[model samples]
Target: MAGHRNIGSAQSQSFSKAERLNSKKLMDELFNKGSSFVLYPFRVYWMKHEQPVPSKVQVLISVPKKNFPLAVDRNRIKRLMREAYRKNKFLIIDSMNGNEKNLAVAFLFTGKNLSPQNLTPNPSLKQRGMATQKKSSVKNLPQYKLVEEKMIEALNQLSKNSLK
Candidate 1:
């Protein structure tokens, strides 16, 4: 190799730091004062406030134990929610426009056990070419799509609210 230099240490990426909200007052304001939009799986609440310095976004993740009785199931859902947010949050960031305002976002898992009545066996159909067409075994997740769409809608609403 003519030139192979290690640049792992030299390279740095700017990542957004999550400012978690743990105060009762903040939580109350978030629920009371903020406007919320439900995208099935996630309900996003946001409000803009003045700050001496630029405020970073705060986030909270929650899973209802009643819905998911097992700790493992709750944890798994939480992990997936976090990953989805992490991957798609950049869209929200881009919408912020460098405002010196704080943001609070929460992802609540609303998934419950599928009803037995809703369960149907996958039936295989023969294709014209060769392989048989197999029905997808994956459960439909409308909430996930709702989350993404509602995020965009919320961002738009937030921007409009900021203008007023």
Candidate 2:
């Protein structure tokens, strides 16, 4: 958490446990074929299907290089996203605990570059026709605010739904 933003409150720190999923088979089983829950910019796809004691949550954060060519930018965004999730995912954990449900979550980055300055249909298009055009990379894409809001909303809804 060095050089990370500490914006959330203490109540958002309940999810402190970190469990590792070492086996590729396990990861595939959980993430590859699992029920998905979509919030918005963040998609939570998980299931109650795992071996051994189901007391832990395995998570993965993704930042598509196709969307963000710069590895530095992608890594930075992923770090921020993970930090945000680590700070906020406690709500979902508590709700899941209360509901007695085991889960596996993956935080995927589906953000696209839609800046007004670079409003082209293709961000990776190098040539338009015969002349050869310059392909402008993704510039000034939308921030992850909506992703955070949608995560909160998803957690809140998960809490509500757990009551039933």
Candidate 3:
């Protein structure tokens, strides 16, 4: 009998190491000189990487220490942001792919600090949905469709700026 192996869907959905913005100099430029747009809770900073790179885009997500005094809250917000970006990044990546350019981007979570109750799990959630996790709920996430739309708008803005 032939062996059955599990499909590597996690790898396909994962944010690989190569797609992370880890360079010090690049990050400095991305913050100091990059263009930004605010979509309520998410502030996106993005710039075309000056140096050539194989990856279409690299992303960094941050939830400020000032806003989230507890590490758990900060980490949870970051996890949600990453989940949103990983699932929706194709909107930007598809555009960049056609033009063959590399982009470095940072997404900062700017939402107000919530009371612990606001971050608690909702018992009614289904197991696997874009906006919820199995153990904990990503409460207060902008709807997945809205997040994707915002990403697309930001990328469109980036392209327009590039033309000028």
Candidate 4:
């Protein structure tokens, strides 16, 4: 049974408390000294951990109240971000496993409200007194598939950066 492995225990795709960045001090340091890059809907901040951490990678997901005024909307966005991260975190984990460095990352939601109704009218159209019509083909990307795709891309980018 040397080669046999339990599929269920092989990879835990769970977002555990241990993998959450919760320390105010560490968070302050990460914000103050971390390198950041914008990946469309997310502004990612990451720093190599100075202290030994239980997990190889820890993450914080933030949805700004300014962008999403409603609590429900913010919560939903956070949930989607969390789910996407939970499923794809192995991208970072596997990349970092060989290295001694532990990583702390923050994912800030930078996109405007995803709801079509909340979309702001074009300033030129507003100034010209032209009606702004919503396009039927343009749908909100609150769906899991779209969010997951972005998450995967972000993680892949971060992994590449971490290698440097």
Q: Assess candidate 1 and give its TM-score to the true structure.
A: 0.56
Candidate 3 segments exceeding 4 Å error: 1-11, 113-164
By TM-score, the better pick of 3 and 4 is 4
- Candidate 1, superposed: residue stretches over 4 Å from native: 1-17, 51-55, 113-164
**Candidate 4's residue-wise lDDT over 16-113, tens digit each?**
99999988998999999999999878999999875877788999999887776657667877999999999888888888888888899999989864
Report lDDT per candidate: 0.53, 0.59, 0.67, 0.81
Per-residue CA lDDT of candidate 3, range 31-119, in tens? 99998878666788888765865477888889887666657667866776777667656555655655645789888878763345434
Best by TM-score: 4
Candidate 3 is scored at a TM of: 0.67
Candidate whose lDDT is highest: 4
Question: What is the Cα-based lDDT of residue 61 in candidate 4?
Answer: 97
Better of 1 and 4 by lDDT: 4
TM-score of each: 0.56, 0.63, 0.67, 0.78
Q: How close is candidate 4 to the true structure, as a TM-score?
A: 0.78
* CA deviation > 4 Å runs, candidate 4: 1-9, 113-141
lDDT of 1 by residue, 13-104 (tens): 23245355565676677778977666545566766655332335555678787665657556655665655555455455555646656666
Over 28-134, each residue of candidate 2 has an lDDT whose tens digit, in order, gives 88677776666655566555643664355556677877778768667767876766666677666666654445566666777664446433333344354422533
